[model samples]
Target: MIEIQNRAGVERARVTGRVVGNMLQALRTRCRVGTNLLEIDEWARLMILEAGARSCYVDYAPGFGRGPFGHVICTAVNDAVLHGRPRDLRLADGDLLTLDLAVIVDGIAADAAISFIVGAVRDPEDMRMIETTERALAAAIEIAAPGARLGDLSHAIGEVLAGAGYPINLEFGGHGIGSTMHQGPHVANDGRPGRGYRLRPGLLLALEPWVMADTDRLVTDPDDGWTLRSATGCRTAHTEHTIAITETGAEILTLPGR
Candidate 1:
């Protein structure tokens, strides 16, 4: 389902995007060496209610995941990457954490993710992996404009990750988002340019670039059946932003103050 938001829809998306951005930013600040994953989920729940918004993930039951992801946010630590359901685990020093969030406000929706190191222990390898994803996300957003194809964005992201010697995974990537958490027009992290759907005004896309330090393979957590971990158990990072295609270019709706 590819949704093209009208002006009013875009405005609503902005509101939802800001809420998501603020929540993520706040969570990043509150995260510490001993902070529990459940506590982070509680903080997300409170923030959503306080903002008068709804979590897209709380009742989300997609075919790829176990039915009904009963959490407000995804807290991925170390080896975990996508769809990381919160658990009773405390963060540790030098742990790489990824927080992915999506919410709805005024009937519109937006999604975003951020990866960072917890505590004061910053491993060089972890910082490089996190920074690589951030750079790849920025590259994709820079090329996201009217008339640009989805492949263009994917290619932009792939160039950065691939150039940094990281393998690309296709099983999970970005997607169109509006009025719901996930939508159609799957955006892979790597692809050929001049192919796939063309960008246009009002189209919203969540562009995310994630990579494991050593491999492209992913394995689902057997215990919870939701969290996706790296096959090699290597450190990983992910970065994302929801952008709305505009008349001349794309506008990043998930920025904190935009």
Candidate 2:
């Protein structure tokens, strides 16, 4: 279902977006060398409770996933990318970590993700992957204005990833988000321009661009039933932001301090 926020709803959405963004920033700062994935999840839980907000992922159970997510945040390290379920593993120096979070405040939901390297080691390939996704995400957002075709956003994202020499994966991408975590208008990472849904004022979309280093294929972890890893075990990166369409242009709701 696609949800359009009214004026009051938009105000609540801004609050939700701010909470999500702040939590993501805090998690990224706390995640360093030797940090446990479980610790990150616990921190997220504490923050959500302290803010009197709700977690969109803790009880999320889609057909694609095994069961209830049963976690407060997604902690993907190195090869892991989307739907990364928190584990007991300790992060090592130079490990690429992806933190995806969603929360609801005052009945509105916002989602966002960030990818960064742990500790002091800087791997060139990892940095390139992270930069590529962030650029792609920005490009997509730049083209996401009211009355703009969804294809325009997709094309912008695809161009960035393709030009960076990374294969685009379509199995999972962005989506419409509001009162619920996930909604209609599946925003693929790669697509033809002038196709799909058209943008309109009051519409909310979560634009995410993710890529694996060597392959577009993905393998789900059997043990946890939530983590999505690269088929080639290559490092991956993801960047996302929740945006709201306004009369003037697209407003990025999931920006920290906004």
Candidate 3:
């Protein structure tokens, strides 16, 4: 469903977005070499409870994914990208980790994701991939404003990723997010401008740009039923933010200090 938030709802969305941002910042700081994925999940649970908010993923049973995610946060590492189920695996130095989170506060929800290297070791290719996604996300957000078409945002993102020599995956992309984690208006990474839904004030959208180093195809883990990985086993990165379209422009609700 597509939701248009009212003034009060948008205000509440700020609260939810701040919590998500803070949690992701803390989780990124907590991740280290040898840190278990389950530990990250537990930390997210604790932080969510402390904030008096509920996780959107813990009971999420969407058809595309395995029933009942049963985790507070998604911890994708290395080649893994989306719907990364928390496992017992421990992170290693140079691992590219992605954390995606969503939560509800005062009846509003916000979603965001971040990817970064694990420890002291960093690969040039890995940095390039992560930076590409971040730049694409920024470009998308820059075009998000009242009266702007959704395709404008998508086109902006696509321009960055495609120019960076990365393959864009069309199956999974950004979406309208409000009372629920995922909603209508599937925002593809690449599209023609001047088409699709027109942006309006109070519209909350989770804009994400993700790309694989080699191929656009994704493979899900057989055992866990989630955790999308690159088909060629190449590196991957994802970046996202929840934004609220405003009268003049767009306000990024999921910013760390928001």
For candidate 2, the TM-score is 0.98
Q: What is the lDDT for 196 in model 1?
A: 99
Give the Cα error of residue 21 in candidate 2, in Å. Answer: 0.6
Q: How many collisions per candidate? A: 0, 0, 0
| Each model's lDDT | 0.92, 0.92, 0.92
Tens-place lDDT per residue, model 3, 1-258, is: 799999999999999999999999989999999999999999999999999999999899888787799999999888899999999999998999999999999899999999999996567999888899999999988878889999999999999999998888899999999888999889999999999999999999999999999999999988888789998888889999999998889999988965
TM-score of 1: 0.98
In lDDT terms, how accurate is model 2? 0.92
Model 2 per-residue lDDT tens digits across residues 144-238: 88889888898999999999999999999999998898999899999999998889988999999999999999999999998999999999999
Model 1, which residues run further than 4 Å from truth?
none
Q: Backbone clash tally for model 3?
A: 0
Give model 3's TM-score versus the native structure. 0.98
